[model samples]
Target: MFLPPRWLQKDSFPEATTFLAAELSDQFLKLLQEVGPQSNEAILVPASQSLALRSQLRTELSRPDDFSPLVLEGMLMTTVAQAGRSLSRRHHGKPPAWLSRAKELLQDFAGAPPSIEEIAHSAGVHPAHLSREFRRQFGCTPGEYGRQIRIQQAKLHLTKTRWPLSQISLQSGFSDQAHFSRTFKRYTGSTPLEYRRSFTSQ
Candidate 1:
């Protein structure tokens, strides 16, 4: 069972038996407000989505102290936003054409992401306007999304290969190993070495 904050009192689930609970910090709540729907009722999550959430929850629980509170907060915010998107899609059909186009632009250029100005030029929009609209559509800036892709690639290399951290860092497009480690830990809540160890130890 999961519950929204006390302020979102319109939601209720009396029949739920198993609970995965967390205290929503102000930052998490703010993120929800930004990306989530303005709904009062509970949303039905599909079994596949629920299973994925359960896996992530278990991973977090297994090493509770390994993550910062901010990283945990981000995880919850992302989960809630995903559920909100599902609800929105069920009600409003698919996303808009412009959003789809923007997503395509982002994905196509993610490996070597263009600057916001360059992206704006490609989209025939002003940089400030593009920045605001992109965040509203995708919940993060284009640069942040590109960094996420790079970090994900780094994680794959860390798990699947015996390459040195410096090599992985360069391949992932970071300036150096230290920058890569800092950014990775900031987003993922674990250092690169620790992430690799978890895989190897298993």
Candidate 2:
């Protein structure tokens, strides 16, 4: 079901297979455009729930009289929403080679991320240019992304181990437990203790 831009004009289906196709209706296309411009080519994301949704869709299609349009539309929209989210995380157009390298460096040094200048040097670009393009492409500054990565690591330790806040903070690149608590709260809308308590209680 991959469709390129203007696919209706360029592609044709055999009569037997026509029933298998679904048009990107104007209403749905408008909804997608509101999120962001639809990519010229479709982007696919491997989601765990997709198989379940597809199975449900098939079951509904088998009994057309019992099928609910609302449920069908929900399934279609969910798949589109997941793809849109994945696309937003990538560059608008084709990504530059350096962008991947820069992301790799960020993950490699998540515990102690490099400075903007250092990252630019590593990626073979000027600092100002890297900052501009990185933000434009990834939708966040490199430092912000690095902080998110650190916080995610800290969250894992918080849930999986009984480590004290101080130790988790140091290990996850925060200056102290207080700083970690504030940052974690800002990002997740829950303090470290609150987050862990919710998970443990569950």
lDDT of 2 by residue, 1-202 (tens): 4354575645332222223445556777776767754557574433233446667888888776644877787777777766665566573577688877887789878455689899899899999999888766765678877887888898899899999999999999988899999999776657899888877876
Model 1 per-residue lDDT tens digits across residues 27-66: 7556655666553545444333555776777777777784
Per-candidate RMSD, Å: 11.6, 13.8
Best by TM-score: 2
Model 1 lDDT vs. the true structure?
0.68
TM-score of 1: 0.55
Residue pairs with clashing backbones, model 2: none
- Cα deviation of 176 in candidate 1 (Å)? 0.5
Model 2's TM-score against the true structure: 0.58
